[model samples]
Target: MIKLCLQRSLRPAVLLSRSALDPAVTVRKVPIVPHIHSCQMGTRGRNEPREPLNSPKSAKDFIYSLHPKERTCLLMELQSFESIAIAQETLQPTPPTRAQIKYVLFHNSIPFVGFGFLDNAIMIAAGTQIEMSIGITFGISTMAAAALGNLVSDLAGLGLAGYVEALASRLGMQGPDLTPKQADMWQTRVSSHMGKAIGVTIGCILGMFPLFFLSDDDEEEKKKRKAALTAPNA
Candidate 1:
């Protein structure tokens, strides 16, 4: 009689045979098919084509070709110094500071003050009540005009910022993986100049407010005194 036992997992099978005359059992080992894991087969099937050294797809790929420790150190160095390198390469002018904005406002106000006084003198000399009202209306209208100017300037600034941010992203100065502090720094640089320009414009508009009341009141006073004197005589 013969009996066979198979084992799981690439192990050898055992065969048992008995001879009727000798009453002794003989055992033999037989080889079985090797076991293969499904995961290993899938991994082999999913192998991607390697990028060539001569034509690397990206900086990351070029870095990845280095030894593990060397790659890690190089990446760390790049992360630390990337911003400095980009800033050195930049050709754009620096954004205006708050102090510079104040200076600009002061300079702009000088001209605006001269113009406001001239306008008031002209309206008052015209001597029509309607001309005085027109001067006041013009002063008030400047506030609205300043607001519109600020809006347009802000929109233009935002458009320019967006274009710069896109370029920075491409150049690796700004990227999707940037930390919070980095993003804030980038936003500050982009917005500070526009804010300064808007502030100066508003300052000039506010400086014009006193012009609205600059017309001479002496004429009205003289007219009132003349009316009183003539009333008693009449």
Candidate 2:
């Protein structure tokens, strides 16, 4: 019978502890060492040996057990790894400044100005057409015509979104020099909201141009219709 024995070290040495069972067999002791490198411990001297650093406790124990000269060699190897980690962290990117966020907010507002103008213009024009073509013929109310116009406007917006994005990308303005994490902060979020509100408000005011071009006759006709409907006499 042959029994296997395992030696625990940086390089494991396996040996057979028992002799062969057969009476004629002769047993010879053979040591097998497996070399495994878990991590690079910097440049090592040919004469120096390596120790396993599996845990803080284990590393401390190994260092305390070493001779003074070998201990210094191991300390130098560990310091090399620590310096590399610090250098990597130092090279990481930093966030941008407040002024850069403001610049981004201004450019973001520009495309939305166009969107608000087109939305209101389309809604008013479609509502007018619906009032003339469908509401009068079918005896539908003005509110119903207006709601239908909004539905049409919303459908048009779905297709218009892609074109608006494409156009804005082509006509790109100077963007903020900011890291992605910095741009996603609360201050930037609030700035974007303010830009959208201001842009849409300005655009909506400009979109009321259609109201100026209406004929006096059309206004008079609408007044007559309302008067006739509200009158008590048959």
Candidate 3:
């Protein structure tokens, strides 16, 4: 039918008009299909929704949303974008297990254990030494001595952080393998916070070992303060 139409259309204009005018011969209208030799008859598909052209926000979205046949219009080199390694986000990540959370808890707590102990112990020891040596001569307040001692402890922490981490690593208590989503879970975060809090509390309690070796000045001051508070003011 197409061949016949093409043959007749190729004829002289006089005969083509007569054939159209005569009712005896019928001229069939050629229906246009959606896709013909990779060329679409219309810009939008018949069944496809007429979405806004500005729907795509970026080049990637526009390209990814392009129909396979539509991609034929692109340059050969540009067409190779399909080969680019993009992140494949398919399956949902598994939630962290109890053991995994425990691992994270211990992994974080272990290193901080030494840190807390050292920070508290060093501060106490340093403060006491400062009071005995330079504080008496300079008439430095106990609060000032404590503040300077804390500074020394912080500086020491800054230096010894790597060593503490290194020592903790030798314990063979590595964190569990989990996705970012799993690691960010409330349970994991809670476990981490709890572990650090508990470790530091214990470390601070242990760090009070220095108090047993110190003079009874603090006790005497506490008694004096209590007596003064209880006594009537003039």
Candidate 4:
């Protein structure tokens, strides 16, 4: 009698009938179910479908049958296609904008009144009584005028700064990213213009200070002095 050995996977057959297996039969391994997946991909040159590697033959046999030149040509074609695809992706266009730069910033004119602090400081430094006198008159009158001027100037300055920032931001340059030199120059120019205006306004006010001390009734005293001096001459 021949000894027969069967594996566990084939136990269904064994369970069906005890005498089904011949005494001489030996089954050490069971056949595995092959997995098949199909992919439809376009190649470099032709748009037609190619035979799949898993169809009816083994992969090793298919690869061994290809010549060296044919393999190199296929690789080169695939590389060229990949390069073209990458180039096209890189060259895509950005969106356009219809809003103008000036429209986003200021409308046009900004008034240059003598209202900023820098202007006041410059005027005071330049001898305007508003800048010159820390005395009672200046303390009351000039201070109020100067403060009013500066407040107006400050509000206007804020608007100007906003306009500039909006313009820069629209052009893709954030306000904070401006170069240190550029920022310094902008601040300096704003300060300089405001200072000039304050200086002019304060100067005109200070130039008229002596007139306040002049008597409105001075003509009577002037006539009396002139009469006495003229009689001596007579």
> Best candidate per lDDT, number?
3
Candidate 4 lDDT:
0.37
Worst 10 residues of 1 by lDDT: 1-10
Model 1 per-residue lDDT at 49: 40
The TM-score of predicted model 1 comes to 0.21
Question: Of the candidates shown, which would achieve the greatest TM-score relative to the real structure?
Answer: 3
lDDT, candidate 3, 31-132, per-residue tens = 322432332212332222334334334334444555666544432212122212112134566678988888878776786788788889999999877765
TM-scores, each model vs. reference: 0.21, 0.52, 0.53, 0.20
lDDT of 4 by residue, 21-107 (tens): 344555454343332221112222222233555533433344344455543443343333333433344364332222322221221
**What would the per-residue lDDT of candidate 2 be over residues 104-170, giving only the tens digit for each residue?**
6787787677667777777887887787666655668889988988887777766665566556656
**All candidates' lDDT scores?**
0.38, 0.56, 0.60, 0.37
lDDT for residue 121 in candidate 2, whole number 0-100: 74
In model 3, where do residues sit more than 4 Å from their true spots? 1-88, 217-234
For residues 86-118, could you state the per-residue lDDT of candidate 1 as single tens digits?
333435445455554444444333333333333
Q: List clash counts for every candidate, in order.
A: 0, 0, 0, 4
Error of 4 at 143 (Å): 31
Clash pairs for candidate 2: none
Task: Report the CA-based lDDT of candidate 3 relative to the real structure.
Answer: 0.60
Residue pairs with backbone atoms closer than 3 Å in model 3 (clashes):
none
